[model samples]
Target: MDRTILKSQLERYRTPYEEESAFIDSFIDLTSDPLAYKRERLEGHFTASAWIVNRRRTHTLLTLHRKLGRWLQLGGHADGDENLIEVAMKEAKEESGLTSLDLVDSTIFDLDKHIIPERPHVPEHYHFDVRYILEADINEPLHISDESISLAWITFDSVVDMIGYNPSILRMLEKTSKSEILL
Candidate 1:
């Protein structure tokens, strides 16, 4: 897991969103350390999340984050892992209890920067989340982990309505809508 690899991947991502482009530039300009994922690094750590869709592509899995108490995608701190894709998949599997997930696309699907409020010992900081899309079976039995209060597979049309309107989720929905696997 090298910072150079992450930098190259971000550079290769093509998106119409100007904000994400800016985020990429900022991420590259900020630091060259692979340990930038650590919270102690402080400038803004790399986080990874998965926009997980079922094989039919009609539904997506979301978790009611226990700590955050919000309906959000499955993911967590990169925790020193420079391979964001692997981090995303690991979080997805850990949170959703889905053992069989296939990468829908190897390319980065979305980018977001959000503030995480201070909680107890953890200080408030920014999370530079790199998102990826994964495909799994909707019919598979899901086991909810302690990390989430609940987990549900929401229909594509009902996502924003169910989870609350989130720009990143909307962006991912738009991207997946145009993907051949989803079609």
Candidate 2:
């Protein structure tokens, strides 16, 4: 994602503890695996998420996630906040550092509720994610962030060609793109 814009935007904040906590809590809860712990129902501690789709050049802006290692859209937990559309905007700004953006006229692509698998080291965590899909236009350039190792503007159709080391994010991208959930 981007950096210069985020750095400028975050310069006024003294500490990011509160924001980080909310985001991390939501993320851990969503990606944790509940079934492995014999829990049939997720606590639903973190059910909210928002992702932005950027139409860039002949393709859409996608992130090559650092941890998840896949070419995917920009998204993160809601931090328990219901203003998911704003959350999508915030994540798009912070992660990609792009300032020229607006939520698509129609939230053109939503997806099925899905479970985020827990990592091997943290199997008890699980997230029942209610994902919202949004789109944006990149009027300027893109900035990258540590959260992702790389970034690209990829076509909606070329996603399947880029294999993901971790299939979870890949599945998410596929499902979100294939479904007609946006309204």
Candidate 3:
């Protein structure tokens, strides 16, 4: 994995939240460690996620994540992929089963660092998730992968009231709501 790309993106990325900004710095610090992109790095590892929206950008696609059991954005482990954009795109397609998806921009859309609870086999760790904006046809069919219990296109207006609301997701929601290109 090319750490330069990740470092470059982090240098250019900006966030209103001080917490996210701290995450950005920590992500940049990870660039020095070659193992940072690998899931084997039990301390923490890179993840890629898609803030998927419809063509109109009125709603966002979320999955009832099977492992985490929460309605969250489409994404997964980077698994040593340096091309974070491709990672995000692949996760979106695999999770949503949407063949046609367009990346709104190559630039970073959001950054989040969240703890993953320890599972039976997997130990607790942090996922330094890098997110990007993606657009798909709302009319297109969606198939739920085994990773999710269900998939739904939740309106941007109603995401706040939804059950299993995540603060990190809400941060992305705030960013999406303010982005002129998104709305």
Candidate 4:
């Protein structure tokens, strides 16, 4: 698909919480099919991101993925439902416990392809579509879950300074800082 068409198609789900039942279909279309990526839809590994920005500051939050050992925005695979926005919303709520966020109609980033290092049951070469949703109303205190070793909402510049951030994470920060996608 042309980049413009692909982005326009993705922008259709501005309010995922509204038309939620069709999320899976959109996921297949947006991703060119779900299973072609990482884990199952229910497991949500096609790389749709759900994010919450500090309503007052616009700074985005991130989780320190325990297993992945990278500072990343909150997101996962489609799980069973493929609504990309729902995937983003669900992942954001589940990862950060902030229920008041609103999903931006546009993406903050579209890193549609990348590989994961090998893990226990999962294989390497796990490709991801990686869409980013900007958030509003991010003042809620976070309640950490097993997916993260720790979590913090920081300025993109600050996150770039972390010691463990890999090249990909830093690249993401750079893109976000440049406002290449959303804000």
Q: Which is the leading candidate under lDDT?
A: 3
Q: Which structure is stronger by lDDT: 2 or 4? A: 4
Q: What local lDDT does model 2 show for residue 165?
A: 48
Per-residue accuracy of model 2 over 157-178 as CA lDDT, tens digit each: 6766764343444544654555
lDDT of each: 0.84, 0.50, 0.87, 0.60
Q: Best to worst by lDDT, what's the order?
A: 3, 1, 4, 2
Answer with 3 or 4, whichever has the higher lDDT. 3
Task: In angstroms, give how far residue 82 of model 4 lies from its true place.
Answer: 2.1
Tens digits of per-residue lDDT, candidate 3, 62-154, equal 988998878899999888888889999999999989987999988889989889999887899999898999999988899999999999999
Report the lDDT tens digits of candidate 1 across residue range 1-183: 467777887778778877667677767754476558787866578899999998878988999999989889999998888888999999999998898899887777888888888889888888989888899988889999999999999999999898787777887888888867556
User: Tens-digit lDDT track for model 4 on 1-183?
Assistant: 233444466555332222232343444354555353446432334657754566554476888898878777788775545455666777888888887787665443444445678677765754455465566565667889899998888776576576364555555555455553353
The 10 consecutive residues of candidate 2 with the worst lDDT sum are 1-10
TM-score of each: 0.93, 0.55, 0.95, 0.68
Worst 10 residues of 3 by lDDT: 160-169
Range of the 10 consecutive residues with the lowest summed lDDT in candidate 1: 26-35
**TM-score for candidate 1:** 0.93
